[model samples]
Target: MDTQQNTALTRALAEVPGPLPTSGVIHITLPHTDRFTVVGNHLAQHPDLSCTAVGLAVRIQSLPQGAKVGIKALAARCKEGEKRIAAALRELEAHGYLRRVRDRLPSGRIITRTVFCNRPAALLHPRRPAEAPPQPAKPEPAPAPAPVPMQRPAPAPVCHPTAAPPAPEVPVAPVAPPALSAPLFVPRVPPPTAPKAPRRPLPQPGELTPELDRAATTFLSDLHRHAPQFTLSEDDVRRLVPGVAAWLERAVRPDSIRRTLTDDPPQPLKHPAKLLAHRLTELLPPVPPGVDALAALDRPRPRFTVTPFQTCEDCDRAFRSPTPGHCRDCRETRAAYAQAAA
Candidate 1:
């Protein structure tokens, strides 16, 4: 009875026409009504984009506005490094899927504004005159139309099957179609730089003093505590030692350096080493002036006049003098009195 039931079930299964019909990737797609992103086929199935670039583009498209999509931010979120992410971004740019514009804020800060395009070719490519509408098919000539005896003046030599080509089965007519995560990474020729002046080489943190090295290393290693995103590797810490040492050389307090570096950092701090390097490069304070210069700046200025008003001792007259004394007239009067009495 079990065998009979198994046979019956197999028959039933074969008779039923259901979804399991192919040996390939199957889609169990559901209609997406809400919170769905529309991706263009050009980007989704671009023949030129690498797998990484395609995936990254999709991720970027699906991201909400104001989300941190910076190279560092994405690197932190995804299983990719800055270099890979950057290259992917470059691919996107080259294909017109991304644009990065440099905008100057009212505060004069230059910021990269990234724009993402679902269909970049539309904007980047010149408007192609609307493709001519396809027309109905017309019958083509037979590959080997033997000459009719009545029409032919003479019998022509027959061509080989290989020599005669068939008409195209169908005319192929395939129609073809940034908010910014970072500053333009477009490779640009660097402007001619002025000849750099020769000066004493800067002291490396390691070469300067063991104490400085120790201080820098300790600060970098412990940076993750204050800012979790700054969790750095041994190499990163080593790379950043020079920046911290620069702060030290300028006599900026270690605490001050930590505070400045850590203060209100961009959310999703992607690359701590790079962030530290930028701060070190751009925000460095001018070398703290020498003691003599500081003294000059700090010297006290008198609030009172150079010569103060003084009251005469004998005449009770006011006089301008450094020390308490009589005015000119009062002094003469006193001297006259003394001489007359003598």
Candidate 2:
């Protein structure tokens, strides 16, 4: 046997005790309970529980109570991705092998705890239909009243008159309208052509220096080479050229920008323009001293002048000299006899 088997055998032999009454001997036992066995069988034969979910449930059961479990930790332990672990955990929860409760602590903080129950759903949570409220008693209808008898009125007398004879009428013949000699022919007119839309003017190259233009072009070319799936339009180029120029103004080399863009971007880029714009903005260096100073000079500054004297706190009136609390007019008028003596 190999070294491992020999070591295990030696340990087993050493652990075997002699025939004597033992005291304070600790015995470890496996779960062999009927409930555990039933749970295992149910997990094995479960229709909705997948193999991964079963494995996750088993792992959760093996762990100690209140163990810290998370998606990343479980993924690393099971040698799988986080998404697969999450999906398996969700499946276990859906199949009644797990239950999650969101509880709030006294500190007003919310936390979610997952509870694993190996027992069947029937024992864990017995289904009891909600009891409906009693309906109100129906009201009694009123009885119908008796019908009344009908009454007839008296008839009036009629007057008789002689009938008049009808007169005879003469018949006339109908006249027909004259028919056209020939049918008129009309020519079909052609539809008018729509006016062509005016083209947008290209950005002036003179706005950017030769070196800046060259750097922008190089950056664009490298971007296309790295991510050929992204197609750059004229508007995109116009929007991005100023950012590139700003980088060049800050003394950032074009090659460095290209390297940063080509570095392992996320696969299946959904919005390349937005991604590129974000990267360019994030990696942009600080403005140079000369540019910052020039900008500071161009910005308008607020002006403030110091006053000659302090204003009174009560009346907010200015004085020639400083006063602690009140102005001269208010100090002369007080609720004391000192003002009367003055």
Candidate 3:
């Protein structure tokens, strides 16, 4: 039953009459006067969304017919951190897009089911008076007087400008008084009969190094300058920084920019556009407790088996797939008509 529904959804999406814009919130037309929007703003805000959420939706929509995906299969496809994957599942469930059933194992770990196409009618076809035709956006009327005006003139000057001065001619004699023996120095008087408050233990000597202090300042300043769109919490800072909270207290510090460049560099990028982007490598801070160690973005690594591959169904030509599906060459030749129609 579930597979049949998935196949229907895939067909509906594949045969959609209009071109689907990928850049913004996607409002997709569904069967039975239903529509759904993949809110782009939400995705942008939560960049940490696991690939699982998106991949699951895509896979379900691509099913040929009568096929149901298990939880483990969905997780394997997502390739995201555990926390993010869980978050994505919860989000889908709360939005009525999924119905999760727990399948507990004897070992105490449980798997969750992913049910698509279970959205209630209330969400899919919400009725709200046709949105009142947007009211044609009437121009605003002139504003009434504000309770407090912005500017007012000062009152007239209180003092008169033309004043007269009087002159005196009489002179007086001066007298000096004699000083006695010098008085003894007085000590500071203590407060009398007051309850003494407990003094706090002197703050344990701050642990700071000169280099760390400078790096921290530079790190924060650069964040404000470059990535002004995003906000980071103290935990974020601690996580980003290698360990400079103590070093800032010391007077001596190294060149912050140099230290960061050496310690945490941006990943090596192949695309020209990505290379030209504002490098996050320079802004990394010392690693704080519980924070993952900072690593350069460009560090090379062996390609994992999870990397996708493709084989042409017609020509039998094999190709390394960057995305999903068969080799592009084979798809072009065999599915050309469908591709053009799509």
Candidate 4:
């Protein structure tokens, strides 16, 4: 595997806590079940773990009884990183799947390594099971013999005369053939498309007089707020009244123009003038003035600063730091824990 994937696998394996062995015993978890979950999930994503793990298991199996294998060498042979292999071994140890052995070689040098050869048959499931032996058949007993019978000679027979034969009967007439059925014709139906509904009448241009225009604009603003689903376009406005677009331009200075032609207004301003501003900024030709123009200038860069913090897991509390890092509760808890463990 690549370095990154190997690192991830290593980290995942390290998350497991257990021991590895050499023969007759398979690595496994003890009372705790969570370790199994982490290992199982890790293996699920990278099946290579199985191959590498099994390879290490096999290598350990090959070693002389009680002989430990170097973690580095095992990892190299398995084409996995040392860290990942260590994680797997750690997980195994944590789960009580395997036991770690530390010793000095005959050279009087210290040996710090792991041996993962085998596990208890109960813990390690065989990938391929051994075939069962053929069963022998049972023999049947012999049957008893039967008794034979004898036959006797025949006596003399008498003869009889024959009578005249009757005339042959006439042949029966054949029945008529069955009537034919008529061919059926089914009408073909076309696939369904959009439904056809009556169209609503467009609002009249004369309807948008100065006074009515104010009312429609106010009503539309209220409608937009309460019923956001319903949106009125510039065409809807211009169609309702003549010169409404021009009136809007004078009433409110929109960012850019939309080349929409309407019956009432020769030139129609676009709906969502802000959206028009963004589009104008992107167009090849120079965009209109206002927000878009101001945005064209280069601005100052933004800076971000983060305050330091400390956390106390024993108390499950967090606090912002005024000076340097220090959590009194965490330190006290760790000290107590160390003393207790010692």
Name the best candidate (by lDDT). Answer: 1
Ranking by lDDT: 1, 2, 3, 4
Task: List where candidate 2 sits over 4 angstroms from the true fold.
Answer: 1-214, 222-231, 269-271, 288-342
Model 3, residue 69: distance off in Å is 2.4
Looking at model 3, residue 184 earns an lDDT score of: 22
Task: Assess the local accuracy of residue 230 in candidate 3 as a C-alpha lDDT between 0 and 100.
Answer: 33
Give the alpha carbon lDDT tens digit for every residue of 237-309 in model 3. Answer: 5544433343343322445543442333344423322221222332333434332333544556778676566
Judging by TM-score, tell me the better candidate of 1 and 3.
Answer: 1
Model 4: per-residue Cα lDDT over 132-212, one tens digit each: 998798687687687676686665765766867988998988986554343121112223575776543422333345775
How many pairs of residues collide in each model? Answer: 8, 0, 23, 29
Better model by lDDT, 1 or 2? 1
* Two-way lDDT contest, 2 vs 3, winner: 2
Writing each residue's lDDT as its tens digit, candidate 2 over 91-118 gives 8766666767789999999999877777
For model 2, the run of ten residues with the poorest summed lDDT:
182-191
What TM-score would every model get versus the actual structure? 0.32, 0.31, 0.21, 0.19
lDDT of 1 by residue, 1-342 (tens): 999999977776566556566686544455898998888787778877999999999999999987888899999988989999999988888776787889999999999989887775455345546789899999997799777666647778887666566677987887655132333333232335857656433234335588888888898898888878778998888877887887887788878988888787787787777777777776777777788998998999769658889998877878789888778998788899999999
Off by over 4 Å in 4: 1-51, 66-68, 102-117, 121-342
Error of 4 at 225 (Å): 22
**lDDT score for candidate 4 against the true structure:** 0.49
**Global CA lDDT computed for model 1:** 0.78
Mark the 10 consecutive residues where model 1 has the least summed lDDT: 178-187
Off by over 4 Å in 1: 1-21, 125-342
What's the residue-level lDDT of 48 in candidate 1? 76
